[model samples]
Target chain A: MARVDRSLVTHLPLFAGVKPDDLEEILREARSARYPKNSAIFEQGADAQSFFLLLHGHVRAAKTTPTGEQIVVRYVAPGETFGLATAIGLAHYPATATAVDDSIVLIWPTAAWPRLAERFPSLAANTLQTVGARLQESHTRILEMSTQQVEQRVAHALLRLAKQSGKKLDQGIEIDFPISRQDIAQMTGTTLHTVSRILSGWESQGLVESGRQRIILREPHRIVVLAERSADSGAA
Target chain B: MARVDRSLVTHLPLFAGVKPDDLEEILREARSARYPKNSAIFEQGADAQSFFLLLHGHVRAAKTTPTGEQIVVRYVAPGETFGLATAIGLAHYPATATAVDDSIVLIWPTAAWPRLAERFPSLAANTLQTVGARLQESHTRILEMSTQQVEQRVAHALLRLAKQSGKKLDQGIEIDFPISRQDIAQMTGTTLHTVSRILSGWESQGLVESGRQRIILREPHRIVVLAERSADSGAA
Candidate 1:
């Protein structure tokens, strides 16, 4: 049995229209689970039996190639819902999700989705909106990958991360999580060596600072300029 | 008053569960409209007032860049839906849709969608499934464009078109539409020169037959082999 956390109800976007009492009712159907750093929650092609709501920490969603190259599609933060395959009527998970750090999540049975959607039209509407936004974002990324250069892609991605999960620090905006150069390379479709070289160049120019495991954007405006240039040239 | 086309209802996947009489009731609100080739049915950034079902001919959904470069994202055929922004609860179309050829389409007012979803939960489910499939396809395309070679991408696109609209002829499986080298180039994210050169190479090898505006797949097996090379290299 999952402990009823009132604050969790307020965080999930799917529960926006759900009254406090109704949320409690829905939460009763969900169980809370915790994962340690680098733990695999689900693997690709596995039966998608449940959906999840992140309560604390971050999760990385990734796809692997036959050659074992991993591409990090996106990271899910606390207050977001994932494993939407059930809502979209998929039988299997399309990608693997792993905990980036110690994380707590609420899991709901797949069977409960339709019943909830029927009882609360707003839930369906919100799910549709979420899917729509994700589709749009994916489309934009496709357009960028098809047309933009790698350096520009890196700059844009950094900006997006800053917008989504940046924390203001004394020197600059720090990405909320520890991300490696390899992770950046995977996200931007570039080599890790290239990402390292670019970051070193930026660091020398006072555009960014590299910590042991994190990156701080010291000059966002300069990175924006680089992104714009890459967007125009269609080269990275 | 809109003329209710009973036969047309059978073509739509959403109407599969609906009785013939129920389909008639649904079609009663539909109005048929004709659009000339190259005519804009709906423009990006315009208020989305209605959704359309293609009854005859084809339409191209495209986005225009700031510099006026147009990129066609999708081509809709008979029995497919367009202007789906309404289904996603969006107020504006994100891309412009134009008639690729003179087309006849059945129009449904945006106001009707909510009532339809309420009255037919199956309809909503079916529509959502279609959207989900499309989103998955888009993601697949993004992955391909990001990682696959241009030749493999073009081959994949051709195979997809053949699957969707091929007509078996005495010579081979003929793509049942007039498509130009430039169009293929755009679809495959390559230059017209590159597409033309590759097609010429394939033509010389008797792999395909290319005429003024038609493409005949003389050896789909060979093309499939080429496409598989990329797929085997680790794209799913």
Candidate 2:
């Protein structure tokens, strides 16, 4: 582990009000770890000993069903936190976090969480906002999955991924990392065949382009309209 | 509007760490508000002026689509909180909170949230758990909605409602409050027609009995199996 850049802590909105000395003291017990692409950072049901501050790259936090199917709960982007069982006051990791690419994250022991939170009230305050926003987003997605058709769900998922992990490209907007049809399916709660078919239709309409593992959205606005599709619009 | 029973705040795990003086000071600005059956405590898109602690009775926190269709996001039971836009750092209520039955709640100005939070950091820490748990539940629902059939979804919704507000009756576990089939439809993201058809089928099987805005689950275990159904199992 290299000497961790402490700026990562101070710069975060969660710690913006934190003093330099306080952040340095907090970072003293923290260490940085890296995981290669497609590697598990932590497995589900393991003792949740720590929480993380993502410094580089991407990761997916997922849960597995009894029958061995995995559901992607969220995508961890840079500067965000992941593996939050401790922050949420849980004893074990409820989901597995896997790196989507080679990634780095600052690790803090679960024991330190309370002390840090008590010492810096904003830690808890800002974390509440983060967790609250996630809850809101999750609720919205559930509504979409339940009310909206497959095409709308897929469109909404892609647009969100683009917002979080998308990189602007000359052609349009590109989802910054390698994501498979299976990954999209897992994220949207659809089958790979269904996702593949949807993507194929989008491609023919010049809405998106896909390669082996990359997807580029040519007109994200159109995708938004697609996502906002009303129940009656489909019948029309 | 009456002086809040301070014990309600202290007894809660969310405020376990706060001093009595602090709790009283925080509650000084709080008041109790009541809503009649089916009346809204707060409406979606309205300025988020306050959040609440459910004291008695049942409530439904829902969001309405642009087309005036409502989606039930949560059923607010006693001891839980709702209309938490301020806790999430939002300016307006993202959803509407309405009394499912005649209900009472302790309401506090959203503006006071940050001040009290800084005074008692546990407010944020405890809220993280609440919001995180919600996020986890929403993720599970998204997965279910994506993968499960409509029958499965309806079964799941019933089982959940039973868990939240069920009352033991001579016949079976009666949903304590009056919830219309349309409410079930919104919760499950199905249509009233579909819900009606399924409930009728269950009635014939003696698994459930429905009477306008009321339902009893005679066989909850079978409903659990229905909720756990797999794609292949149905075909088989």
- Best of the candidates, lDDT: 2
Q: Interface RMSD values for the candidates, listed in order?
A: 1.8, 1.5
lDDT of 1 by residue, A1-236 (tens): 64767875675677777787777778888899999989999998899999998888889888776557677778888887888888887999888999987999999999998888766666676777777777777766766665677888899888888887788999989988878898888787777888899899899889999866699999999899888773445323
True contacts kept of each: 0.27, 0.76
Q: Candidate 1: which stretches are off by over 4 Å? A: A211-213, A230-236, B19-22, B230-236
Error of 1 at A231 (Å): 5.9
Model 1 agreement with the true structure over B91-136: per-residue lDDT tens digits: 9998899887789999999999888876766667667777777777
lDDT of 2 at A187: 85
Docking quality class, candidate 2: medium
lDDT of 2 by residue, B1-236 (tens): 57888766578866777778877887887889888998989889999999999988899888877767778898878889888899888999999888989988888899888888787777777777888888877877776776677898899889988998899888889998888899888888888999999999889888998889999999888888877877568432
TM-score per prediction, in order, is 0.92, 0.94
**Candidate 2 residue pairs in clash (backbone atoms < 3 Å):** none
Q: What is the TM-score of chain B alone in each candidate?
A: 0.91, 0.92
